[model samples]
Target: MTKITHFWAFFTFVAFSLGLSNCRTVKNGLDEKIYNG
Candidate 1:
């Protein structure tokens, strides 16, 4: 039970980290285009 809980927490952290990374890149891309153009 303890191992399962640990795995779940790690999985959740990775999932949210990937999502935030993706969102940040997308946001930066739009910001660059808007201000540089």
Candidate 2:
């Protein structure tokens, strides 16, 4: 039970980090296009 809980927590953390990185990349792309346009 404890191991499963730990795995779930780790998965959630990884997913959250990936989502944040994706958002940052999208924002950077938009900024680049706006500035370059």
Worst 10 residues of 2 by lDDT: 1-10
Candidate 1: Cα lDDT at 5: 100
lDDT of 2 by residue, 1-37 (tens): 9999999999999999999999999999999999999
lDDT of 1 at 28: 100
Candidate 1 lDDT, 1-37, residue by residue in tens: 9999999999999999999999999999999999999
TM-score of 2: 0.95
How many clashes show up in model 2? 0
Q: How many residue pairs clash in each candidate?
A: 0, 0
- C-alpha RMSD (angstroms) for model 2: 0.4
Compute the lDDT of residue 36 as modeled in candidate 2. Answer: 100
Candidate 1: residue 4 lDDT (0-100): 100
Off by over 4 Å in 1: none
Q: List the residue pairs that clash in candidate 2.
A: none
